[model samples]
Target: MSQQSSKPEAPKSGGWIKPAVEYGPIVLFFISYKIWGLMPATAVLVAASVAATIVGYLRAGRLPWAPIITTAIVVVFGLLTLIFHDDTFIKMKPTVVYTLFAATLWGGLLLKKPLMERLMGTSLKMDHAGWRKLEARFALFCAGMAVLNEVVWRTQTENFWVNFKFGSIFLTFLFMATQLPMIKRHMLPDPAESESKGAAGE
Candidate 1:
């Protein structure tokens, strides 16, 4: 009889669509802001974020809750920016969103939830210690982003902050790329390999 593998199958990568899923909304918002200023750009951002979420769900067969949560914040802040006629609310979106993410990650660690594993366990096969390490580091990264966003929007000119926001997508992706080594170092043993070693009595 055939047997199922011990782990869930990793989900499909969603191919080239993944970049558009992640960055298209932000790029559109940047362009809109360049042409139309904050109010119209806020509207564009809110719509683009919603569209991205829908496209992501269609591609992956599941909603990406991480971005959904971020988009929700954008919706609220964007609405405020429109209603109140102040860009400050939208400007604060990144800080609040990143702070919430950091808090959730650290809180999950405190409660022993392994939240990162729950979200990525299928795609990432790693030991418990590895999961915990990745979780803590990601939490720290979020916290750092929150502080950085706050500093930029508060101290910098609007043009400077907008440029920084656009630039940050690449920085964030680069940071993720740098984590590949750590992920490789901490990979779990393949079940087939483990079984082979067992059969060999090694």
Candidate 2:
């Protein structure tokens, strides 16, 4: 779910490394799909996804759950698609992933645990109520995405679905942009500032 790290550094020279390593395989898969076809694309995606995960592990010293889980599903569904000569399995990967994410988030809430908090707590300091609201909204959002993916793949052409898959990044960015205001509202006050104010009050 989260990439564990000993030290985090912003690359000064190879600033493009992270994005390249992350998205290169996806771009390759898309290109392969257009040139080759469904089964070839599935094969290409499985190979590229695994390569990406290896790159990530070599860079970060561990496999982050997001990519690892994604790669696993890709391998499973991709192999099924290849073996069965059916593209249906490959088309359903996003739905399966989104559903799993939604269930995990909601299930964590039911267990009185905030899974996202464990993953992102160091970066985002929010109160209990804030975290609950954020998690609930994100869970619903993922569920909606699952349904939307199913609708698109079921009703549309494969080419259209492929375009939608890439274009969905814009929608995701817009959604996150809209959450900036809410994030600001729920941001916890700096502890050092609070301590300084308390000392001054005395």
Candidate 3:
């Protein structure tokens, strides 16, 4: 075979690409709203979502499911907000998104497919028990987030809600940090090392 044929395949988009696209729109939305207002911010968010999707596809050679879903939601709700000139549609976006996540997670568990395991199993090496427990925790956390958004949007000022939208990213990181210990404890054992230890014992 030619050396060219033996060359490694190019890697797809990962790491910073995912989070930056996911959260960058929210940050821009907050800034836009602070400077202009909700309608304009919503427009900026919708545009950003579309741009992020295109960027992801251009870099990765295929569209990612998360960004596609996010773009769809943003475009739909953003249009609704602009059409009606009401903030209600945009404000309920987080609640709807989180509720969908919670529902998807629970449905996956019901179908005997752990949600997190299916989504992150490639990157996260954890035993079945860990995956199951992590899935449950994530589902619960999503539900909590939905409820929290409902409360905040229904009770707080528009400015506060915008701030909370940005703050939610921080909350997500905090939640993951809390799971580090559990994840480490439940990581899959090293098979080769285990076998070596068993051979030594024998």
Candidate 4:
């Protein structure tokens, strides 16, 4: 009789708290900017963003490109806001972030890869076809977000934009949750073990 060995299971996914650590600064920035207004709050918000960026990099054991770039931009714009006494710099932050995200996603599509796959590479497993479909959906969502951001900021008050930014995070969570069903349905099972189980049963 031969003994069979079982393979190790994959690690469990990290909880939402992990992502909250990354986005918490943006939430704080929106809150502070609205409650205190840009003049008095911009410095504090920028500092928080910088701190969050550092914490994120430390937690991940490497610097993430998006948060690092965003932190740098926030610091530069925050300084400009202070020096010029103009809120326009701070106001443009969302536009810049969304535009960059949109461009990256669309560019990935052009290059025959999805930017989301690259970002989530270590976190999930899916086949090429699954990746392609997921990537296309994510790219479209990013583009839609970019347009929606522009529309809200242009048509609404500063406070409205601030609220919208905070609220939009919920939508992102929902979108991610919706993909789980598709992922489960398309995920490949362990074929060799399954065949062995069938033989044993027979």
Considering every candidate listed, which one attains the maximal lDDT? 3
Instruction: Name the candidate that leads on TM-score.
Output: 3
Please give the ranking of all candidate structures by lDDT, highest first, separated by commas.
Answer: 3, 1, 2, 4
CA RMSD of each candidate after superposition? 3.5, 4.7, 3.6, 4.9
Candidate 1, residues 28-96, lDDT tens digits: the string is 989998999878888999999888888777766676568788878889999999999999999999999
**Residue 10 Cα positional deviation in candidate 1, in Å, after optimal superposition:** 6.8
Query: After superposition, which runs of candidate 1 have C-alpha atoms over 4 Å from their true positions?
Result: 1-10, 13-18, 193-202
Candidate 1: lDDT over CA atoms? 0.84
| lDDT for each residue of candidate 2 in 71-124, tens digit (9 for 90 to 100) | 888899989999999989988988998899899889989988878877667667
**Candidate 1 RMSD computed on C-alpha atoms after optimal superposition onto the true structure:** 3.5
How much lDDT does candidate 3 score? 0.85
Candidate 4 clashing pairs, residues 3+ apart or interchain: none
Q: Which ten residues in a row have the lowest lDDT in candidate 1?
A: 1-10
Q: Write the per-residue lDDT of candidate 4 for residues 153-184, one digit (tens) a residue.
A: 78898789878877878878888788888877
Q: TM-scores, in order shown? A: 0.86, 0.83, 0.87, 0.78
**Residues 129-163 of candidate 3: C-alpha lDDT, one tens digit per residue:** 89988888988998999999999999999999999
Query: Model 1: clashing residue pairs?
Result: none
Candidate 3, residue 16: the lDDT equals 51
- TM-score, prediction 3: 0.87
